[model samples]
Target chain A: MSLSSTNSFEKSPVEKSDKGTPDHGECLKVLSLVLDQEATDEEQAYFKQHIENCMPYYEIYNVDKAIKSMIKDRCLNQKTPSDLVESIKSKIYQQAD
Target chain B: MSDNKRQSYSQREKEKTFEQEFLPHIDSMYNFAYRLTFDEDDAKDLVQDTYLKAYRFIESFEKGTNAKAWLFRILKNSFINDFRKKSKQPAKVDYQEVETFYNSEDVDKSITTDLRIETVQDMIGDEISNALNSLDVDFRTVIILCDLEGFKYDEMAKILDIPIGTVRSRLHRARNLLKERLKEYAQKMGYKN
Candidate 1:
């Protein structure tokens, strides 16, 4: 399997008709929105309607993880670039010298 | 006046041009640089360098255009042309080696699970930073301007000097990538079953 490969939004694999195979793709898509609970009524309705026809918990889990990724903390120091500025300045001076 | 006076007058003119046209925008530039560099120090220096470069070529600026976008484009080009280079001392990055950095990983952070919104609210400020960093530089830059900075598609298209479709497609993919990262983080933290 190609490492960079991913299912496109238009052709999500979770959209199967039968309930036998879980719709992991669609679940993944919706789960991202689920994190916020901020989906529009229409968005929620669409998800419910689609899932009702073909349930896919696998896809749901995938989406869940995506949402968590969205909400993960990765903040760095906000006021941390002054030293880098000095470093760059020093480099420029050295180059000139 | 002597030629010495002429030279001094031009130097002052250059300083005033920089102060008025470029210095005033330093904070906004710093904000963009912070997001771009993922480090405050690098961002500050990048902005300062961008200002200096802008100063050097202040004559090239046209009479009336979007100065913000022009400055940003110059800054971004400078990043690609200068700062992105690998150091002679052999640091972690090599373009080919880092190529797979964008490849998808098989892990949690899927989009299907239900995490409490409060958990998200608790983590978003920090998580937003995480999500931004997780992305490759290209994807991160696009998402930062579009999502975090709230630039519209057309404006982003103009600023990035790319077709609108590229912006839209990149953003769609970047958001997906970010979602997956958050999901992985939550699962690692045992935020969900």
Candidate 2:
């Protein structure tokens, strides 16, 4: 397998004909909404149940959640410059004076 | 800003609100600016300008409302009008064009990189940061607002001046794009399934 190789998510439910089940795209959308806390109660319930039964959805959910946390953790490290705060405060004071 | 429903604040109350409400979000504002401009000096100036505008428009701000979201809206507007206009950043595609392209069906098929969770967890360095920075500014903004700042969908819609549906769709697209970027980095690090 080439390192640069790219392929669709393995074992995608979209590739199969699981009757009455949501496809990969719908599952991904619900998963995103649920993780972001934007999902309604029904969507959340749907995701919970879907992930339990669908292995691909479960895997995708874990990976998606991990990526979001990693972004939050990595991006939070860049401390704002120390002087910037003082500078802003001083400017506000000067403007008021 | 010219709406007639602006709040009236005494000078003391204005300062109080600024200190108690707005100033607490300085780090977040600075981080947002830094992410947008991707330059330290530009980020400082942008943050300062945003604060200045926020203070000037302090009368429009309710005393006990979502101060962070209000400040973010101001900062985003300032970045668009001031920084994005003059900055020599590459790939300055029109927002409409970018949105249309992202909305296309082909994008999903084209970026089906099988990035593993372990490989993503292994990126402890600047890999994640670089991947984030590589995204289009619009996409980067959504991730920072949603993932980093923890803004809700409605709040994000207000800050971005878009419908809530747009915010949700854009954020969804942004995350997928971000995953694609991370997949590229994983490949670089010799991750294979």
Candidate 3:
């Protein structure tokens, strides 16, 4: 699937963080944290704005996100065996006895 | 279930909780077990065992809380305690060794892959799935938890029984490792990346 360009963050102006510019390695960590929603609001704001000016960071962000979506889309498609549910319920009923 | 306090649910309430709160997560639970075991029969057994244990100890689960995370923690623990021992996969590697290796100075050097966004998007499901399954299980678990399952770092920490910092770094390493694997596929496909 094509990446959606609809996020407001992508349209935000490029700006460097006041904490000083993060190196590539630091940027990678920050990117993961931001995407995982584990980063503080300030960190999220800084990375979103900071990525606008950095091509490599932008590419990494998109590629990483796409990979995550792809995994979720593809790897998780296995159907839970239909009989498994009935079996679990029967066992639980047995436990109640 | 946190060890601090356990909520006692009556038998009827226990069955209600299992039906409403727990069963909804069965599909995700099964997917997780399947990913870990890579065998349908083993995954099915694991999920069945997890559900049975969850019911037998239903009193431990707090209502209206994160049943998914609770169930995940149990499944992960069960995998370790039971499945990991007799697993027919390659011999288990020491966690410390893998952690130390990945924590070395080399890991911070930014292992860049030439795989492009279009290339990743172009890849079929099997390519991506195979690359994901190819990682060491520890690395694979982090990605599956964060990326596939969308558990926040703190939730992942509690589920995996590791510090949040370890969760963050392990996930980062895992993503980079996944990209490295994908890059091989790109090269094999004659992409000049």
Candidate 4:
């Protein structure tokens, strides 16, 4: 089934300044930190400001966020088969015995 | 109590503590194992092997400090060692190839094809799961640890036995690859923007 058609892309700020436009490498670094939620307040501010002025950074940021959300929602929910736990316990108990 | 009695009591106490601290992480551990091995039976065996090793090396584990992380480290190492031996397939990524690809001009063209949010939002959970599973083992591991398990970068560094910088770089590459793989699916879902 196809995903819902929700236009979640944020509008890039119309205000453009030549000063804060980060190159691809810097954009990636900030994007990684941003995704991990490890970016410092200053780093976050820098990233927020850069993305507003640069379409590439904004697009990459949103794409990465969506991918992470998809993974967390989907892949993490795989149920641990019930028998695996029993099997592990029995194996551990056998070792003890 | 006799010396022998005292030693046995301590041993039993250690075992009990180990059980208490480690057992609760079974579901998470199993989920990780399943993702790594991609088969139920293999996942079961991997978890069993990991627990056995954890028990054997219980002396090395410091008590009450991130038991989940400790166990995960062991499980990940065991998977690497055992998965290699059992599969008899080379699981190693050629860094030179990856480096060349990323450094190439093609990356600039590819990056412009932004993954449509509607495409990802429309996907079923299994689609996402399969997309994640399609990633290289190293990439998948970082995503699973960082995103799925909510491990901090430092924690991932510890678990994967790499420096924190490597963790960041690997995670960056991993997410980028996932976006590339999913883009095709997004296009199929009729995503326009």
Candidate 5:
């Protein structure tokens, strides 16, 4: 059985809440803004702490990651370095060994 | 070693010294260019061009400003000027088109809403990369900066040469787009809903 099967995926049931997440949604926007540097340092620190403690806040960072994939794939996966990077890498490994 | 000399480093000297700084950032810049162009070959060229241009214009960089942002601006401009003009395709898209069709939000008409978080997190990087390539450049740039590079929003605005408001809106739109792509990728990857 392959884990990637679409059928294996389940849309987890929404757990009922008496209160709406207007503030949570607002917090999401705040964190989102933080990822872009729009939030104030105080707010940044606040959200940074919140994300460390909260799952939803971490979700914001993942979304940010999905967006950043563009540059990462490009920057990380380009042409092989001219013997330069390889030589340096070998030297470092040799020294380490 | 002194103030005046530091202030007056010629472009060639700047390059000689900054190459150490610049070399370390090359792969990141190349990856950025690759994602922006969606072509590995073009990505390499773009990165090379960005470094060359940055070397020539290092003097113009304000001493205290973000060098990464400066390089990104150069890479982005190079992408827009070099590649975007050469491609011919049907381009303007409302990314919401994809979002609306995949309406798999599971709410029982009552309780709390739980966003499916992990599978998206676990999706393959290449497929994820392709999804990013699908977005229009405007939305794509913000995602690239914030998500992959870990750039802050204000720093992103500074790098992108756009207002923070524009950055916010594009990021909002871009995330919605990525969610849509990931959902589809999930479907293909065989994740059952």
Candidate 6:
């Protein structure tokens, strides 16, 4: 598929939904807040209801969820080298002395 | 106690506080540095420089504030001012280049020929990390700070020295770019269009 084709699908979920669905942008915002665990109880409930009833909202929610899970699983999994801590401690202490 | 001895004692106290307050964030600092530089040696140097600067400016750092955020701010500044300037590697493609290429008409033909979405589907950690690293530094930094380090939007704005609105927009763009890079893999994982 063409790059433009791929990108067309990748447009901001807030911006891409049908024009008649005015609440799509609000849904997208609430979805983001939900993902970040920053949504209020009322907002979360609204989001849950929207996702259940709206196909576009469901699709956006699922895609965003998968992307977030992959990033959390793969990108943030690196263990900081053990010695690095001691090395920094020693180096900083040396400079202090 | 004598004035000279008192001064030394206060210095030691400050040093101890520095160690206690800031040292705990070494792992985080190192991880941030590693993600930014993508090189062990460079990450080490950057963390070391950050600590040194933190120590030097210890007097100015208010006690009991968000030490982690303060340290992160320092680390970020050093990365921009020092590490980027001294990097031995050739200059990276800036956001302008990436934007221009993606927006250009040739993108359609070039993507079909050069895109390797299938290979990325089977890939795991390093593959994903590479995709993130491939993003322009600005975009990559936001992901590292927000997704990886879990910085709040306002915290990120403070650390990156940008407005909160800028932070939101940048984070939005960063996530979009990352999603674009990993879209094939997401599709394989049953992500719907």
* Residue B118 in candidate 1, Cα distance off native in Å: 3.9
lDDT of 2 by residue, B148-169 (tens): 9999988998898887656766
Give the docking tier of candidate 2.
acceptable
Error of 1 at B19 (Å): 3.4
What are the models' TM-scores?
A: 0.55, 0.85, 0.87, 0.82, 0.64, 0.71
Question: What does fnat come to for each candidate?
Answer: 0.19, 0.46, 0.56, 0.48, 0.18, 0.26
Clash numbers, per candidate: 43, 0, 0, 3, 28, 0
Question: Looking at model 6 chain B, which ten-residue stretch has the lowest summed lDDT?
Answer: B1-10
Q: DockQ for each candidate?
A: 0.15, 0.29, 0.29, 0.26, 0.12, 0.23
Stretches of candidate 3 off by over 4 Å are: A1-22, B88-111
In model 4, which regions exceed 4 Å deviation? A1-21, B1-9, B97-111
**DockQ score of the complex predicted as candidate 6:** 0.23
True contacts kept of 4: 0.48
Candidate ranking under TM-score, highest first, comes to: 3, 2, 4, 6, 5, 1
Best by lDDT: 3
Top model by TM-score, which number?
3
lDDT of 6 by residue, A18-76 (tens): 35453554565566668766677877877786678776556555655655666667886
* Candidate 6: Cα lDDT at B162: 76
Candidate 2, residue B103: lDDT: 33
User: Which has the higher TM-score value, candidate number 4 or candidate number 5?
Assistant: 4
TM-score of chain B of 1: 0.69
Q: What is the DockQ of the complex in model 4? A: 0.26
Judge the docking of candidate 4 as incorrect, acceptable, medium or high. Answer: acceptable
Which digits, one per residue and each the tens of the lDDT, describe model 2 over residues A1-97? 1121112222333334247765555566567678898777866776787778876667677888898888888887767998987899899899888
Q: What is candidate 4's lDDT per residue for A25-84, written digit by digit as tens? A: 344556677778988786677678777887866776776788787777777676887787
Tens-digit lDDT string for candidate 3 (A1-97):
2221223222322233444665454455568777777777767777876688777778888888899999999998889988999999988787677
The candidate, 2 or 5, that scores higher on lDDT is 2
Comparing 2 with 5 on DockQ, the higher-scoring candidate is: 2
Deviation from native of the Cα of residue B53 in model 3, angstroms:
0.5
Q: Write the per-residue lDDT of candidate 1 for residues B31-118, one digit (tens) a residue.
A: 7787666566567767877866765565666534456766777788667766666322222223232222223332133233354444
